[model samples]
Target: MKARRQRLILEIIRQQVIETQEELAEALRAAGFPVTQATVSRDIRELGLVKVPGEGNIFRYAAPGETPPLRRDERLKRLLRSSVQFMDFSENLVVVKTLPGEAQGVASAIDQASWPEVIGTVAGDDTILVIVKPKKLVTTVLQRLNELARG
Candidate 1:
């Protein structure tokens, strides 16, 4: 039951912008899942859904890792071009500097990218610490980021 409902949740979110738990629950009920708000919330957490800015001031849920690859790449490239001031690396880490208050947005974009080379990221007000998977891949990731920033 949980698996089927979770699958429906993914399907619904992919089909339209679901902005709230109530909205999701309603969608599930309409789909015949008849889920409660608490159950929907738990499913959201378990599915690792993250809220991304949607139209207007609203936010919509997204399964970060499941975003279409081409769209994800384009979004990441656009994000880097717009917000990344400069980037540098040492060993297995890459530090990205962004305009003030922009690091978090850029970092979130990177996280949503699900890049194999990236372990994770930590963002401050204007700085982001990116942990690369393999130490040798730091240069590769840096180069890719630079290319993305350039284009």
Candidate 2:
């Protein structure tokens, strides 16, 4: 039932501009789902819906793009460009800051990049500890992070 409702939520969002949980709940009710605002809210989170900019400066819920494996790199690059707040390094550890709740995604992107200098990454709520192969390569890793953040 949860999966079906989530699928319906996705369909409704794709078909129209759903800007709020109330609006989404109304749509779901109209579709015979008998939903509450809280249920709709949880469904939205479970669906990985994001409110992105739409026409006339409004934001509307849409599905995330993780379904397409081919766009993972492009998604990573875009996430890095938008969420990377600051980067610095000491010895073989490069530290990166991101907006709250974005560190994990940024760290995952860094790990997916498979850069020769990166040994691994540990992410927190808003910070990432990136392990480098050698202390000497810290500068190189930092430079690469800077470039990703810039573009």
lDDT of 1 by residue, 14-36 (tens): 88888899999998898888788
* Highest-lDDT candidate: 1
Highest TM-score: which candidate? Answer: 1
For residues 109-130, write the lDDT of model 2, one tens digit per residue: 8888777788899999999999
RMSD of 2: 11.1
- Find the number of clashing residue pairs for candidate 1: 0
How close is each model in CA RMSD to the real structure? 8.2, 11.1
Can you give the lDDT of residue 12 in candidate 2? 89
User: What's the residue-level lDDT of 106 in candidate 2?
Assistant: 91
Candidate 2 regions with alpha-carbon error over 4 angstroms = 1-73
